[model samples]
Target: MRFPFTALPLLALAACTTGPDYRGPETARPATPGAQFARASGDTGPQAPAAAAWWTALNDPVLDTLETRALAANPGVAAAEARMRQARASLRSERANALPSTNASALYVHATVPGLDLNDSGDSDQSGGGSESLNFYNLGFDASWEADLWGGKRRGVEAARAQLDAAQADVADAQVSLTAEIAQAYVHLRDRQQRIALARDALARQREMLRLTEQRHAQGTASALDVERQRHLAEQADAALPPLAAERDGYLNALATLAGEAPGALDGMLAAPSKAIVPLPPAQVAVGDPAELLKRRPDVRAAERRFAAATAKIGVAEAARFPSISFMGLIGIGGTSPGDLVDFDKLAAIAMPRLSWSFLDFGRNAARVGQAEGARDEAAAHYRQAVLDALRDGEDALSRFGNGRLSVASAARSKASADRTAALTRQRFEAGAATRIQLLDAERQSLSAAQSLSQATAAMTADYIALQKALGLGWR
Candidate 1:
């Protein structure tokens, strides 16, 4: 009987595949707008920084170099990229299952029987022990295809595609995080350097005051006790420098490591005074609605994809419970002699359509479906949590940016007032009108104000960096 190839297409068209249709979960809608951290100032509509290279907006050449190096060398980012490639391969493999498969096989064999035949009958057949050579070769094609009578294969492919997309998002997320971390480290290192310089300056100024008090004592215009107090203040100021220097060194080491170098490797680059302020990108940070974040954030998207995969697995298990039908066929010629392999007498051809359904194992299929559903629920929960975190970080970063600017402003005024008060107190002491204790108090107040100003400046820089990270705008 000849089965025409054209019949296959007609059969496929006549068959109906069964399986659950996939529709993305509707839970992806955005969270409320009011009081959400993603909301920017004014309703001009939430704005993200330009999609092109967010780090470039800072306008720092050094930053550009560091970010480039980190993205290339960071282990976490590299691993994420590798995983994405694997996910894509998996998706492709799943999709390929939706089509028919053809396999070609060839076999060759030689054997000898030295004993009687091993069949049992009322009269046993016996043959004299003899050496005989048997050689046969067969070349055939076998094909098997499950009529996707249900959307099982299609659903599986859909789930895999979603997972592959999620993996790509994860890679993006890793890149975003790496850039933010590099920026944060660089800014902190610069601030430490500035603070170290400020501490040294304070020590020098105190030493000058001490020298002047000694001269007054020598001229009998100031008491010996006043000179001793001034000396003590100078010593206190000098003592603070070593600890600040130690902290500066610690930050330097950290920065070097982040740039993918051995500790102290980047000291040469940072040794020069880096007083040039790192530019802040934008005064305002915008967070689109939480719903938008689900689409934008890679981790959340990855979780959603995992959920979709698990949902499809449930249908896969359900399909396993139904009868599986497949078509198989082989055509070839075989003979004891190699030259006779193609003889008409030795030709053989077979075609089969097999249907298999397990009469037992009812509990196994049900258990598999249960497992898939449970996994899906877990993935959904993780996705929800990711959204909440993104919103929280965005809101928190904006608040810090605003409050940090205020802190720096107030600190500046305090430093200025303390400076003026110190100058006047010193003049009074030189005229012998102010007590030694009063002069000492003014010096301490001046030092305190200077430290406060340094702290505020560092805070302001850090807040801006944080705001950008929270808005998910710095990793483009």
Candidate 2:
């Protein structure tokens, strides 16, 4: 059935409510020319996503499995999903009023009458009594729906829909964050494992050098001070090993926890050796566009929806101050017995329209409207801030990732040069061509350079993870 034309004006007015409209804030695009990474070929303003499973580029089966498990069982992910479910339920509740509601009922009544005789007095005896029972049955349907004359219901529905959208965006944000975190932890764990190996190897080399120095000293070819120095170096290297091992264990435990597994459960999976390599896409990452990012990023989308919800709330608060019109109806049949109750002659129906007003709650209603407006303003500010933050994050990540790559390469070269120096120094010492002091210095240099490389590699991998996160994109 069609609504009366007179009701159409109310809906049109509701569609024109004075509330803030959400639109993304202004943003700057990435530099077209000077960006560190080259844009992908056939790229428009923004690059198309490079690869869906970016982690696969690392070629690690264990990491892939861990990522999948984390997505499924991570506490944060579960919380996000629950929030989405709640939003969905709330949306359903809000829409329920858009349609009419119906109800049914039944009842019974009984009574007795007592009487005394008067004429029997002459006859010297008399008595009388009467009893009756009545049963009523009512089977009927009654429905009433608000005209939504001012679009209040529609606006409320709009707000609920926006909230649902925001909840979904939150889930996406949580997923993206989880993936980045897992990758970062995995990289750190691998770096620590490599460091542990380096420490052990350094300790072995130090012991061998100390043994040679002691042998030379025994033959009176080396000074006691030189032998003592070698022993001290070996002890220092040995001391470093335990800490590296501890760190490696800590990272492993962290990864296990993040993957929703008990600590040490992942030990077997990660028990195998691994290396920390900064997994940059074999090609440049395609960051679509700065404007596109505002739309694509879940946080940004969530913020926008929040702003819309806040705007709608203002209408809800405003609608409260006006008369709330409702239609009510009742229909039923009743008689002394069940068969008579169904008689068409006893059936009846009644309908009425009711209007309610909160005559004494002006202060409370005004305060609610004011509160909604304030909330809308706050949401607007937050939305703008979120947009700015996204741009800054992307730019910072790209800058760091670019520089970090160079730093890793330099550190690796330094480590290799130090290794060569240490090896030659040892050979020379063995042939009596180099002093013990020189050989000790070469070993220290090699160890220091190796440590620097390990640190740089870790930093590089971390920056890559940060870049992906900032881009608001990652493996699903």
Find the candidate with the highest TM-score and give its number. Answer: 2
Clashes by residue pair, model 1 = 17-149, 17-150, 18-149, 18-150, 18-151, 30-291
The TM-scores, one per candidate, come to 0.81, 0.83
lDDT for 177 in candidate 1 is 76
**Candidate 2 Cα outliers beyond 4 Å, as residue runs:** 1-52, 109-136, 274-283, 422-448
lDDT of 2 by residue, 108-131 (tens): 665333343334332212353333
Question: Where does candidate 2 have its weakest 10-residue lDDT segment?
Answer: 36-45
Q: Please estimate how well model 2 matches the true structure, expressed as its whole-model Cα lDDT.
A: 0.75
Give each model's whole-structure lDDT: 0.71, 0.75
Question: What lDDT score is found at residue 156 in candidate 1?
Answer: 77
Quality of model 1 by C-alpha lDDT: 0.71
